[model samples]
Target chain A: MLRDITLGQYYQADSVIHKLDPRVKLGTTIIFIISLFVFQGAWGYAVAALFLALVIKLSKVPFQFMVKGMKAIVFLLLITVIFNLFLTPGEPLVTVWKLTITKEGLRMAVFLSIRLGFLIIGSSVMTLTTTPNQLTDGLEKMLKPLNKIKVPVHEIAMMMSIALRFIPILMEETDKIMKAQLARCADFESGNLIKKAKSLVPLLVPLFISAFRRANDLAMAMEARCYRGGDNRTKMKPLHYEKRDYIAYAIVACYVILGIAAGKLMPLLVSGIIQLV
Target chain B: MPIILDKVSHVYGQDTAMAVTALKNVSLVIPDGQFIGLIGHTGSGKSTLVQHLNGLMKATSGSIYFNGEDIDAEGFDKKMLRSKVGLVFQYPEHQLFETDVFADVCFGPKNLGLSKKEVELRAYEALKLVGLEDAYFYQSPFDLSGGQKRRVAIAGVLAMKPEVLVLDEPTAGLDPKGRDEILDQISRLKKETGMTVILVSHSMDDVAKYVERIIVMNKGSVMYDDAPREVFRHYQELEQIGLAAPQVTYIMKDLQDHGYDVSDEATTIEKAKEEIKSWFARLSAVGKGR
Candidate 1:
C-alpha cells in the first residue's frame, strides 16, 4: 500500500532524457515551469503542453505513471478551480438560483488548473528519469560556485540525497510496524476518529523508536567510514554535462521563444460565451 | 481448524509500471494442531504467504479458508481472523509501545473489546506463558533486555488467545541462549495451550528440531513440503536452491559416505546418535557370530 505513493518517486529508464546531465534537467524543468505560467493564450498553452508531452515521451516513462503522480495534486487543483470559479468578481455569463458564473472566472479557473497540472508533471518528469544520487550530485555541482559566498550547498545536497534514499526504507518499516500491531488485533481501519487515532499509538511509537535507532546507526556508520563533510570529498560518479545537455538546453530556449511569440500573436479566445454575453 | 489456501496468487502494484509477482499460483493446507515450519530465502514470498493466512493480504486470485469457511469472502470479520491467527513478526519487540509491560500485553485483549478485568486476567496469564515474572509487569518494557522485550511482544499476541500462532523468525537477532529460550517457550506454549504454531525461519536446525512438517519455498513457489526427514533426503535439491539441511543431517550424511554405517536421513543429533549406536551393536553381534 505504501508503494502506491508515487510522489517524487524515481523511475529507472534508459533514454536520452534519462542520460542527460541532472543539472541540465533540473534547470530546464524550472524554465519550463516559468514558461507554463507566462503562456496565456490557447496557442501558448498548446505549445507548452506539446513540449511537456515530448519530454515525457522522450523519457520513455509511461503516460499512466505520470498520471498517477498527478493523483496527489488533484486536491490542490480542485481547490484552485473552486476558489476561482466562485470567488472571482467578473461579468456574469450564467446565472441560476442566485449563483453567478462569469466568463473570466471560468477562464481563470481552467487556465490556473492547467498551468498547475503542467508545472507538477513537468518537474516530475525530471525526477522520474534521474536517480536521487545523480540529482544530488548535480545539485551540489551546480551550486558549487555559491560556496565562495559561504553557502552550505554540499551539506544541503547531502541531506537531500540521504532523505530520498531512506524514504522507501522508512516506508517499509512503517508497514511492518502496522502489520505487527494488526497481528496483535489492533483495529486501525475501523473505529471513530478518536478511537482510530488511539490505535496508531502502538504503530507510531515503535516507528519513531526504530527511525531514531536507524538514524543513529547510519550516523555512526558514516563516521566510521570517514564521511566528514564537504572539505575533501571525491565522488565515485562525477557529474559531467555532455553535448546532449547543450542540445536539450537549446530546445528549452526555443520553447521559451515560441511560447512568448504565441502568447503575443493569438487572439484571446475566452470560451465562446464571453462574446455572446 | 485447518487453514487451506487454494491457487492463491499475489501481485504487488498490480496494473502499474512497478508491478511485481510476489506469489504465484500456490496452494497448501495446514492441518490443525500441527507444528509447521516455513523455510525460504529473503523475497521468496514466505512473508507474503503468511500474511495471507491471517487476511493481512488479500490474494489477487483465489481464496483462503479457515475452518472450511472462505476467509476471503466479503463480510468476514478480518479482526476476528487476525485474533485467531496470531502473527509475531521479525524483530517484533520493535512494536512494543506501552509504558509498562503489563499495559503492552493487555493492549491486544483490550482492543478485542473485552472487559477491563478480563483484559488484565489474560495479560497476566499470557506473560506467565512466556515465562515473564509477575514482578516485571509494572516495569517499562523499554527497560527490559532484548530477549525479555521479545518475550513481552510475544505475550502481547498470546493475550488475544489465538488458536493458531504464526511467528516470523522469532529468534532472528537473539544470541544462541536467547534463541533456545524463546523457542523452548514457544514449544511449551504449544504443548500447554494446544495452539497450532507456524514457525517461519531460514535456519534448518530450528525447523528440524521444533517442527514436524517443513515447507520449503524458493522464488515464490513451494519447492518441498513434507516431514523434516523427507525434506532433508533431498539435500542436494535444497542446496541447489541456496538452502541447506540441518547441521546434524549434513554431518550424518558425511559419516554415512565415509563408511561409518550411519543413516544419511537422520535429521537431529539424538536420532543420529541412536542410529550410530544401533549400528555398532549390530556390528559387534556379527563379529561374535563370525
Candidate 2:
C-alpha cells in the first residue's frame, strides 16, 4: 500500500522537453517559481498559467499525473487557506460568528493557495521530466564553481544520486516487513495515537536492522570496487546543452519579463480587451 | 471444512499501464489437516497465492472463503483469519525484532491479545517444537546463526497456534543439513498436531518426500494438483514449464525404460528403493521357475 509516492519519480516520455539538458530544466523550474511570487495581478498570473500549460503539454507527461502529486500537500494547503481567511485584518466583507472575512483576506488566501499549488506543479515538471542521474550531473556541473572554495560538489552529488536510487529499494523492504508482521497478527491500525506509535516498534526495529545490513553490504560492495568518494571520476553520460536548451532559456527569460511587464501594464491591457470585445 | 478460493484473480498495479496479471482465474479448495506442496518457478504467482490464504493481500477480482465465511468481506475479522493462517514469509529471519529470542517468539501471541501467562507458555512450547534449546532462549535473536534465526522466526508464528501454517521458501538460504532439519521439524509438527501445512518450495525432492499432495503452478495457473506419485508421472510436462520432478522420479523412469518391472511414478528415494527391491524378488522367482 505504500507505493503511491510520486515526488522525485521520473515519467518516461519522448519529447523535446525530456531531451533538453537537465540544467535548462533546473534553471527554468527555479525561474518559474520565482515568477509565481513576482506576479501580483490576475493578468500576470494568466501569463504564468499560459506558460506553465504550454510547457506541461510539450513535456507529454499526463496532466492527471501532475495533479496527483498535489494530493500529498492538500492538508498544508487547507491550513494556509483557513488561517489567511480568518486572521487577516482588513475591511470586513462578511462576518461568521467570531471569524472576520475581509476582502483582502479572501484575496490573499486565494492567491497564496494558487502560489503554493503552482510551486508544486512547477517543481514536478523538472523532476518528472529528468532522470535522477542527469539531475545529479547537472547539479554537480552547476555547482562546480563552489569547488574553488572547497564545497565538495562531487561528493554531495554522488550522495544525492545514491539516495535517490535507494528510495524504491527501501520502500519494497518496508512493504515486506509490514506484511510479515501483519501475518503474525500485529495490528498497525485501530489503535489510539500513542498505541499506534507503540505498535510500530515491531515494524520499525526490523526495518532499521535490515536497512543497516543493506547499507553495510552496499558500502563493502562499493569499497570492493575501489570507489573513493567520487574523486577523479569521469562522467559516463556527461551533461551538455543542445540548441533546444538555449531556446528554453529564452522562453523562461521572456516569461519572467512578460510577467513583470504585465503587472505594470494591467489597466491598459484590460481596457484594450474590453474595447475589442 | 476447507479454505476455498473461488475463481480468484489478482493483478498488480491494476487499471494502470504497468499492470500485470499475477494470478489468473484460479480456484482451489484446500481441506483441513492436509500437507500440501506448492511448487512453481520464480514469479509464477506461488507467493501471491499463499499471501491470499492469510488475507495479507486481497484479490483484485474474486473472493476467498475461510470456513464458509467470506474473508475479504466487510467486518470479517481479518485479524482472526491471520492468526488462524500463519504465513512465514521468505527470509522470515529478517522479521525478528525483540531483544531476546523468547520475547521475539512471544510477539505473535501477545498481538493475539492472550493473557501474559498464555503468551509465554505458547512461546515456550513453540520454541521447543522447533527444537531450540533453553540456552539460546535469552540470547538476542540477531546473534544466532542463520538457521537458528530462521527457526526462531518460525516459532514466532507457531506461537500463535495457527490452524494452517504456510511457509514460503523456509529453507531458501540454509545449507543442505539445515534445510533438512527445518523441513523435518515442520513434518513432525504436522504429524503431531494434524494441522494443515502448505510448503512453498523450489526443491522438488523436499516436496516429493514430505507433502501428501503436490500443486504445480505455471504462469499463474495450477497445472496439476494430486498425490506426489500422480503429479510426478507427468514429469515431462512439469519439466517443460521450468520445473522438474524429483531426481528419484527420473531414476525410476530410467529403470522402467531399461526393461525392468518397476513403477516409474515413485517420487522419493525410499519409495523407489522399495519398488526396485520387489522387482529383484520377482526377477529371482521367475529365474527359479525357468
Candidate 3:
C-alpha cells in the first residue's frame, strides 16, 4: 500500500521536451520558479500558465499523470492558502466573530495559491520530462562555474542523482519490508500516537540496516570499477543543445518578457477594478 | 479449503503504461497439512500467487478464499489472514530489525496481542524449532552469521504460529550447508507441526526431495501440478520455460536409454541412489532365480 507514492517519479515518454538538452530544461525550470515570484498580476500568471501548458503538451506526458504529482503537496498547499487567506490584513468584506474576510486578503490569497500551484506544477513538468540521470548531468554542467569557488559541484550532482535514483528502489524495498512485518502480525495502524511511533521502530530498524548495507555494496561496486569521485570522468552521452532546445528557450524567454510586462501593468489594472467597485 | 484461489488474476499497474499481468486465471486449492513446492523462473508469478494466499494483494479479476471464506468480503480482517499464513520473504534476514534475536522473534507474537509470557514462550519455541541455540537468542541478530540471522527471521514468522507457512526462496543466498540445514528444519517442522508448508524454490533437487507435490509455473499460469516424478517426466517442457528437473533425473533417464533396467523418475540424489541400488538388486535376484 505504501507504493502509492509518486514523488520524484519520472514518466518515460518520447516528446519534444524530452529531446531538449537537459541543461536547457534545468535552466528553464529555475527560470520558471523565479518568474513565479517576479510576476504578481493576473496577466503575469496567465503568461506563466500558458507557458507551463505548452510545455506539458509538447512533453506528451499525460495531463492526469502530472496532476497526480500535485496530490503529494495538497496538505502544504492548503496550509499556505489558509494562512494567507485568513491572516492577511486588508479591507474587510465580511466579519464573523473573530474572523474577517477582506477583499484584499481574498485577492492576495488567490494569487498566492495560484503562484504556489504553478511553482510546483512547473517543476513537476521538468522532472516528469527529464530523467534523473539527465537532470544530474544538467545540474553538474550548470554548476561547473561553482567549482572555481572550491565547491564540489560534481560530487553534489552525483550525490543528488544517486539519491534520486534510489528513491524508487528504497520505496520498493520499504514495501517488501512492510509486507514482511505485516506477515509477522506487526500492528502499524490503530495505535495511540506514542504506540504508533513505537511501531515504526520495527519497520525503521531493518530499513536503515538494509539502506546502509546497500550503500556499502554500492560503494564497493563503484570502487571495484575504479570510481574515484567525478575527476576526469567522461559521459557516454553528453548533453548538447539542439534545434528543439533553442526553440524551447526562445518560447520561455518570450513568456518571461510577457510576465514582466504584466507585473508592470498590475497596479493600473487593480486601480481600475477599485474604481469600478 | 485451506486456501483456494478462484480464477485469480493479478495485473500490476493495470491500465497504466507499465501494465503487466503477473498472474492469470490461476485457480488452485491448497489442502491442509500438505507440503507443496512452487517452482518457477524469475517473473513467473510465483510470488504473486503466494501473496494472494494471505490476501497481501487483491486479485484483479477474481477471488481468493481462506478456509472457504472470501478474503475480499466486507469486514474480513486481511491482517489476521496474513498472520495466519506467515510468509518469509526472500532474504528474510534483511527484515530482522530488533536489537536482539529474541526480541525480533517476539515481534510477531507481540503483534497478536498475546500476553507477555505467551509472546516470550512462542518466540522461544519458534527459535528452538528453527534449530537456533539459546546462546544466540539474547545477542544482536545482526552479529550472528548469515545462517543464524536467517533462523531469527524464520523464527519471527513461526512465532505467529501460522497454519500455512509460505516461505519464498528461504534458502536463497545461503551456503550449501546452511541451505540443507534450513531445508531439513522446514521438513521436520512440517512433519512435527503438520502445518501446510508452501516452499517456493528454484532448486529442483530440494523440491523433489522434500515436497510430495510440485506446482510448476510459467508465464503466470500453472503448467503442471502433480507429484514430483510425474512433473519431472516432462523435463523437456520444464526446460522450455528455463526450468529443469533435478540433474539426477536426467542422468537416470539417459542410463535407462543406454539399456539399464532402472526407473528414470528419480528427481533427487537420494532417490537416484535408491533407484540404481534397486536395479542392481533386481539383476542379482533374477540371476539367482534362474
Candidate 4:
C-alpha cells in the first residue's frame, strides 16, 4: 500500500522536541537546512549528521519509522547521484566508454546525496514531531508580518494546513480506490511502461474525482461554519515559545556555529594531512 | 467451504507506535451459497476480514484458505481469487470512471480477459440483476441518481460473476427508500444467482431481514455467529458493544418483561407480526377458559 506514504505525517510522543513550540521547531528545521547547504566540508556534514542523530533520539521517533519516508524518494535520490557522478568534469577517476567519472564528480555526488538525504530526514523530523495544527499556527505566526503587505498570511497558512491534513485522507482514499480496482482484476504493477501507465487510468480517474469531491465538501463545511476570510480570529491555543522551545533554539544556534567553524577548519586540516603525506 | 479463516490476525503498522491489530484471532468458515450478514461497529475488523478473502490484504499472523488451499501459500493465484470473490467496497460508486454505465460494468469482465462479446453479455446480465433499466445502460454513471450509481457499481462487480460476493456497507449514506431498494435487490439477486453472499453492515434491521446467518463482531472478535433470532436474543450484550438488535426485539423484550404472552424472538417485522397475532389468539383462549 499506498498507506506507506508519509507525506506530512505526524508522530505524537511526549519528548523535548515534541513539546517544543511549533514555530521554534519550524524555524530550527529551516536554519538546519540552510546550514546543511551553506557549509561544504566533510566535518560540517559529520556535525550535521551528529545533530540529526541527537535530534532523532530526543524526538523519540524511531529510526526505522523515519527512514520509511525515504523509500518514496529512492528514485529521485538515484537520479541526482547519477547526474552528479557523470556531469561534473574534473581530474578523471574512472572512464567507461561514454561514461566518465572524475574526482570532483565523485566528490560532488557524495556531497549532493548526503545533502539531499539529510534535507529529507531533517524536514521529516520536523513534520513527524509537529502536528498539522501546530504547523498551521507556526506558519501563520511566522508570516504575520506579511499581512502588512496584504498577503493574506492566515488564509495561506489555513490552506496549507488543510492541504497537509487532506494528504493522509487522500492517500487512504487512493488505497481504497486501488483496492476496489484490484478486486476487479485491474493490474497496475506489471507489463511495459505504456501498459502500466494505461492501467493507471482506472486508478487515477477515481482518485482525482474523489479529491475534488473532498475539496468541494470541505469548502461547503467551512462556509457552513461561517468561515469567511481569516480577518479577526483568535487562537484557542496561541503559539507561544515555551521553555523547551528556547532550549531548542539555543541548541540550534550552537549547531550552526559549530557547523560554520568545522567548515572553516576542514581545508586546513585536509591540507595539513596532504603536506605530511 | 468457499472461504475459511483460520485464527486469522491482521496487524496494521506492526512494531510501530501506531500499530493496531485490526483483526484478532478470527477463525471463520463461510459455507458456500449462504447469505450471511457480518454486523460490526465501525473498525470492528469486518472490512479487514472480508478483504482477506479476496487476497487484497494478507493477514499479519494467521492464514486464510479458499477452497482448502492456503491463499498466502507461494504460487497461489491471488488474482484468480480476487476475480472469484469480488469485493464491492463502501461507497463503491466512487470507483465509477467510465463514460457510460455499460462500459463501467464491463470493466471487471474486460479485466478478467474475457472476449468483448462475453464481457458485454455479463455486463448486461449484471445490470439487469441489479434491476437497472436497459435505457440507463448507455447513460453516464455520473448522471445517474445516487442509488443508481451504487447499482451500477455493484453491477460492475456482478459482471465478474464472482462465486462469493462481499459487499461492505453497500447502502450506506443513502436515503431510507434507496437503502431498502438496494437491500431488496441484493436479496433478490442472492436468491436468483445463489452466489455465496456476505453482507457487511451495521444495520441490524437490514441484516436481520435479509440474511439467514448473522455474525456479530465487536472489537475485532466475532461475538455471536448464529441465526438472527439467536443473535438478537442477547440484545443487552449487543448494546454494550455499540450495536443494537432490530427495534422489534426490544419491543418484544419489553412485552415479555411486562408479563405479556409475547415471544421475544420476534427479531424481524414479519416474525414480530406473527408473534403478536399468536399472542392475541392465546389471549382469546384464556378468555374462553375463564
iRMS of each prediction in angstroms? 0.7, 0.6, 1.0, 0.7
In model 4, which residue pairs have backbone atoms overlapping below 3 Å?
Answer: none
- Model 3: colliding residue pairs: none
- Candidate 2 local Cα displacement, residue A180, angstroms: 1.2
Per-residue lDDT for A1-277 in model 1, tens only?
6878887888888899999999999899889888888887888999998899899889999888788889999998999898898778899988778777788899999999989888889888988998999999998998999999999998999999999999999999999999888888787887799988987888899989998999999999999998888987888988776899889999999999989887876554444457778
- Worst 10-residue lDDT window, candidate 2 chain A: A229-238
* Predictions in order: lDDT: 0.90, 0.92, 0.88, 0.91
Residue B230 C-alpha lDDT in model 2: 89
**Rank list by TM-score:** 1, 2, 3, 4
**CAPRI quality band, candidate 2:** medium
Looking at candidate 3 chain B, the ten consecutive residues that score lowest on lDDT are B10-19
Higher-scoring candidate on lDDT, 2 or 4: 2
Q: Which ten residues in a row have the lowest lDDT in candidate 1 chain B?
A: B260-269
TM-score per candidate, chains pooled: 0.95, 0.95, 0.94, 0.92
Candidate 4 CAPRI level: high
By lDDT, rank the candidates, best first.
Answer: 2, 4, 1, 3
User: Residue A232: error of model 3 in Å?
Assistant: 2.7
Tens-place lDDT digits, model 2, residues B48-82: 99999999999988899999999989999988998
Error of 2 at B205 (Å): 2.5
**Candidate 2 TM-score, true structure as reference:** 0.95
* Ranking 2 against 3 by lDDT, winner: 2
